[model samples]
Target: MTASPADAEAPLSAHHRKKQPEQVRRALLDCAAQIAAEQGASAITIQAVADRAGVTKGGLLHHFDSKQALLAAVFADLLEQMDREIDRTMAIDPVSRGRFTRAYVRACFSDRLLGERSLWGALSVAIVSEPALRSLWSGWLDSRMAQHAETDGDPRLVAVRLAADGIWLADMMEKAGGLKRYPQDFERVLLAMAEG
Candidate 1:
């Protein structure tokens, strides 16, 4: 048998083929998220996601059994990313009440998290399907609120927390002019609350 020029590319092709499955799954999630961002949750179906991901429907199903599973995976990925960010922030800053709160608020309002429509849809699906997850989310927020209350006796901390949450909710809902209609002035309000 004689070797040809195509043989030289065989190794690279094999490497790509080996890694392509994971890449496809990632692409599916990313594309689905983008579609959800632009068109809303109704656009995030298995067929649409698979088509967007450029994979066969069978391939997508192998990664996610159902739409709910896909949504849960998305939420899990978002939370895991948040945890990594929180860990990084903690490593850089001393663990003070104010520092912790400020870092958290900064992280929440950071570009990575702001106006993340996919995460909101995923969170909504997860919350509806998994009550425990809802409790967990609520518990985390409540704990943070309690911590702020302990550090700052002002009732305004609750309002500040709620205001921050309102920002998130508005972003999630995709309500027109939400941010402009109820601007929270995050930096100014958060600093006053956390500094106290």
Candidate 2:
């Protein structure tokens, strides 16, 4: 039997069919991030993200139960992917100094997952709004703080951590005019701090 034109036009990939769920999940998260980047997190409604992703609200719900869930997935995916990329970059340490810490600092500013960082401020606000998430995030932070204090002999470890976060947050909050501009030597400053 000969195939019709419509049949010929059908998608040609079994692999793509198998990956549909992952693709849909990624699309929804990307759509939410784009919305946050464009109009802030308050603009990130389920309907809006569903429409942007070219999926029905029901379709979106199949993957994310609520707006918070979607936002959480987006934020978590961003961090996870950033960690992977930073780890890869850190593996090629030419300077051979504070390899892991420098990679983390680099990841904070040079996140390549999302183009604009407006989503970061949105996610930060979201993380604080949810108590469970807030606890998880703070506990993770506390552990990192402890590690920093133990590794570095500096008595001002708290100040160092806050300053590093301030530098990164300044860049991330650019859309909100939180910081007019990161100083020209911002990365250098962070790198120097990473070394200390």
Q: Give me the candidate number with maximum TM-score.
A: 2
Badly placed stretches (over 4 Å) of model 1 are: 1-20, 111-160, 170-174
- How high is the CA lDDT of each candidate model? 0.64, 0.68
Model 1: number of clashes? 0
Worst 10 residues of 2 by lDDT: 149-158
Cα lDDT, model 2, residue 32 = 94
User: What TM-score would every model get versus the actual structure?
Assistant: 0.67, 0.71
Model 2 over residues 19-65: C-alpha lDDT tens digits?
48888998999999888877777789999999999888998999999
**CA RMSD (A), model 2:** 4.7
What are the clash counts of all predictions, listed in order? 0, 0
Report the lDDT tens digits of candidate 1 across residue range 1-196: 8879888666664336655667777787788767766676556789998888777788889899988777656555566676677657756765455555565665656642344454554355446557655666776666655655655335565555566666666655554455565554654667567657
For lDDT, the strongest prediction is: 2
